[model samples]
Target: MSPSKPTSRQFEMQLEIAAPRGAVWSAISSDTELRRWFAPDAKVVPRVGGEILWRWGDLHAWPQVIEIWEPGSRLRTRYDSSIVDGEGGKLPLFLDFFLEGEGGRTTLRLVHSGFGPEATFDEEYDGISRGWPVELRSLRLYLERHAGLDRRLAWCTTTIDLAPAEAWERLTGEEGLAAGSALDALTEGDPFRFTTPAGDVFEGLALCCESRAFSGVATSHGDGFLRIAVEKCGGEHQVWLWLAAYGPAGPGLDELEARWSTMLERLFSASGSMSAGV
Candidate 1:
């Protein structure tokens, strides 16, 4: 009997953004800005059938032709390249993007296909899985630092009253307090383990922390802020809390707020009896 021909496979990457469709469309469709995050050297022609190329030094990426372009709503493309398979054979590729807007949020979905049967889907998936987070972060930073750029993410803020020393204790000390709730414990350098009330655990990093401020970045939760200040009531200490959550507008905001508030209250209650050490 004759051997069967190899079958093609598919891959995908997706993210729900807090910003509007127009904002995301501008960032992704613009050649100059897209290069800042998506690639070191990238160029795109927005019209249908136009070509998009991205390269960095000796590493050449697959060429993609615009398949569908619906302004802020959707953009799809087909990859015209030879991706090496495990057995040293080349395979064709196809990719697509689906963008949907709901109220004040947007959902970005990416689908890549045409991975021949011999292709290593796991390898490709792993690389893209790790790379997207960094790219998304770069995207967030770009939109934020640029004054005229629209903010696509939502913000949450709260205040905690404590002394500088006490605030530090609640954040860093292990007093079985709930402050440790929202706070993930740093294991190596900034690396930390994050856990949610729903029992979902994520690996993250404490990007910055000091007597007066703290900041962290989590893969599942994005970024957060905790700042300390002298209380207006004199001699007392206070902490300002802030967090940014990505994806479409959903129940996540209220849930995050509740968890954060509970954690803060626990932290305060636990550290309340401790005397100022700073």
Candidate 2:
């Protein structure tokens, strides 16, 4: 008897942006533009058989092999086998980008396909499902609002053994990010305001609120974007806080990073003895 064919799963999303086609193309296919919002560092060789690198600091560098490159229209890539999840991964996981734009506004579609239906693929599958929304929204924010400016970013991430919901509660606790009950009364697209434990106030339209995630504009930070997500990886809940500020006052991101990092550690880590940050 012949062996069974592996089943596959995928994710798809679309966006409408107030930017030109060339700009959107560069944002996805160019290494320089990708570094602004997608990841801390990136490298792209924009052709079939070439490679793209998605780097997270000095630790993780995810690589993909380009399979199709159509300049401003479409690009497709397959996963590089070296980074497969443990031992049971089926190769050829693909990411496809399709763009159609005219005049000053453009529509972009993303399809991430070729995932296996096995437990080994669970961690990465979940990670990508949670991560891409944050990255893509950062892209839209860059093109529509902060285009052509160097982005200043402050990011903090920590992992706790707790479930995502529990970790999220601690993240929004009175002693932490401290979002008020006013947010609970707000709905998507509704104007909202809240203050953090650090005495920072933010006012913006609500964009997202989930048991494990929260996102909205940070109008006070030079009209910047703020996102917090709790991701589950290999049974551990990882909380990530990312802030992107544009214009002259980018919030001294390094200072903010140090501050938030200490906050997360004290709130989530085994020891509450870490030093206080900015």
Candidate 3:
């Protein structure tokens, strides 16, 4: 074997998107274009050997360098950062995007590799595997639906005083998402829709669904992407909710944030009273 590949270290995925190769290329390589669907803030120089910077507010910044560039055909970038290793050491991660187009359709293939050995395998692989599909769908929505429009982004985090497992239960419970109720009947590429108690409908293609997280394209609103994830830190479980609107109007960011905050508070409040047998 060629230096025996680490288990799940390299992930390759391809999807056909309803857009031209140029559109797909711009969505991935252009800094301002990426902000609409990829990162909250992006700065990139398109040529090979150029520096690319992506940021999610003050929470994280992944600085990458363009390794290869062929415009609408192929592009490769490398990220060397201590953030992924989590030990103040740099780890190299590569992201390759290849595109082939026929008429108005483009096949986009992504190769993400360079994850460290088994010592850091699960933590890195698990997170990226669950995230890529949703991100790809977001890309599709951006290129196919909102090619030249601006987007409104909303992000929020809610911390529950319960363990990860317990908080996960409530999130997927009947009163919460109850994803299992609909998940069993849904399959990949199939239409997935869920109506919240407050009458908001979340519709999309059924993407990734696991015990701790769920993500999909929000078809109810064109060019929208939604991810709801719960991760445990210390004694508390934090629920992260991220949604982006590529459309020009409606569902303002302030209103979206308030809605999510109220929903989280209600879930924890109800769970608390039930624990006290109220």
In order of appearance, the predictions have TM-scores of 0.47, 0.86, 0.80
In model 1, state the lDDT of residue 55: 59
lDDT of each: 0.51, 0.76, 0.73
Q: Which ten residues in a row have the lowest lDDT in candidate 1?
A: 225-234
- Per-residue C-alpha lDDT of model 3 across residues 142-248, encoded as one tens digit per residue: 78778888777667666566777777766766677655446544556677777766666778876666667766677776637777778543234567777777655
Candidate achieving higher TM-score, 2 or 3: 2
| lDDT by residue (tens digit), candidate 2, 1-278 | 99987797788888898999999999999888887767778899878899999886643588988989998899998884324655778466789999998999989999988777877666677677766766677798889988878777887777667766777777877877887445545555777666777666767766666556777777767778787777664455567787778887585778777878877887888822222211
Clashes of 1: 2
Candidate 1: pairs in clash:
19-152, 162-237
Q: Model 3: what TM-score?
A: 0.80
State the weakest 10-residue window (summed lDDT) of model 3: 269-278
Better of 1 and 2 by lDDT: 2
Candidate 1 structure quality by residue, lDDT tens digits, 25-134: 77777777565445546789989999877754233364678888888877777763345645766554666667788765777777767655543455554444434444
| TM match of model 2 to true structure | 0.86
Off by over 4 Å in 3: 1-8, 81-89, 159-162, 174-180, 183-185, 231-237, 265-278
Q: Which stretches of candidate 1 lie over 4 Å from their true place?
A: 1-6, 83-90, 119-126, 144-278
